[model samples]
Target: MKKFIKKIVLFLSPCFLILCLIVVADPFKVWFNYDDYNSAVTQNGEHVRFKLFNNNKDKYHFDSFIFGSSRSHAYKTQEWKKHLKDSASPFLFCASSEGIYGILNKLKYLDNLNNPIKNVLLVLDEHCMRGNSNKKGHLYISTPALSNESSLEFYKTFVVASLNV
Candidate 1:
């Protein structure tokens, strides 16, 4: 029993150290000022991520949303809104090397918003999908109502990824 315990500890030690490193690196700290802050919040704690989510129904609401990895960061929300000639929300929930699973996870958050989303623009980054073939582009499909399948699948993937790291 002691030997078995020791082996388990040895195997998990490196993983624990890596997790500590990541937390100390503070990836989210620097990103707070990036697109994440802009899209998710306004001057105060007011949520500005979606123009049509709740308060500003009388005015124009965001009919479209952008979904993609960090490479998609190059596309600015104001520029996209101008180009499309429509109110569209730009999401920056993606990270480097993120795959379809990441995109799906982000959509799950939108699916829980108070207001409904009408359209979504998913950016396809070539490098992320290079070796992935079984990609089902339905990761970003969402409904206003919370989906049990989507929630469970997303949480499952998140837990697995977090631990596997």
Candidate 2:
């Protein structure tokens, strides 16, 4: 019994040590900053998703909400703010390229809010509708309402972001 216990400890000790080393390295911790602030970490990886929307309700109430894969994140809020031209109407671009399932997850959580999201721009890459075997016909369906009205742009930013992620 003592020999068996010794073998188990010897096997697990290296793995445990490697895990400790990786945590101490903190590789992604420094890459979490944008807009001169480390808000991405504080927003996505740390705080609960719904909490973010709820906390900022006063600022985003009756505003336009942008949703999409990582493609949407590439848009600079300052540039979009000017495009919107309505200073009082605040907008947020909450985007992720984790696939359609990810976007749906975020939308489902945010949809619970009482805020009036006048426009939801679904900046999608072609892959958002195709190669999505992960969710089984879930996020690929066409919305006729948005199809006729939404502006379609093939931005280079989304491609770069997709590669980075």
Candidate 3:
């Protein structure tokens, strides 16, 4: 029995060490607060944008938003503000590869926050309009906060992904 236990420990030790490294290193920036993320690793821009908005929403008090995939980046906030009331504080709520579900969830999240959504500009392409489900992969998954997904599962997905490479 003691020999069997030793073998079990030996087998698990590497996995335990890898998990520890995942927690400490946090290559995906999921476990720590960061000023900026590594650009080389494609991150979930949706999660990053949501974190930024959630953290600074009170300070900025954004009332207007531009929502879409990377294409939305073309619409400058300053330029969009020109069309809205002077009191409008516009924010860009874009994702790397946004889908319709992502856009709806973001809107729902803001509504839940009781945020005054004064104006919205939605830039959509064929793909954005067609997609009806949350994307998979670490770089495309919607943020758990907005998607109402289990936080554990979200982190686990990243941890598993990190292990793959």
Candidate 1 TM-score, true structure as reference: 0.40
lDDT of 1 by residue, 1-165 (tens): 999999999999998896666445433222123334432211211112222233343454445666665566677667766766444654333444445655554466556554456566677867656523223222222211222345444333433344443
**Candidate whose TM-score is highest:** 3
Indicate which candidate wins on lDDT: 3
> Which of 2 and 3 is the better model by lDDT?
3
Candidate 2 residue-wise lDDT, 22-140, digit = tens: 44542323222222333332223211222344556676563666666546667655666666747445444443333565556555554554555555656778766652322211122
TM-score per model over all chains? 0.40, 0.50, 0.87
Candidate 2 global CA lDDT score: 0.44
Among all windows of ten consecutive residues in candidate 2, which has the lowest summed lDDT? 146-155
Which stretches in model 2 have alpha-carbon errors above 4 Å? 30-63, 83-98, 112-116, 131-165
Clashing pairs in 1: none
As a whole number from 0 to 100, the lDDT of residue 51 in candidate 1 is 21
Q: Which has the higher TM-score value, candidate number 1 or candidate number 2? A: 2
User: Residue 110 in candidate 1 has what lDDT?
Assistant: 58
Local error of candidate 1 at 68, Å? 1.4
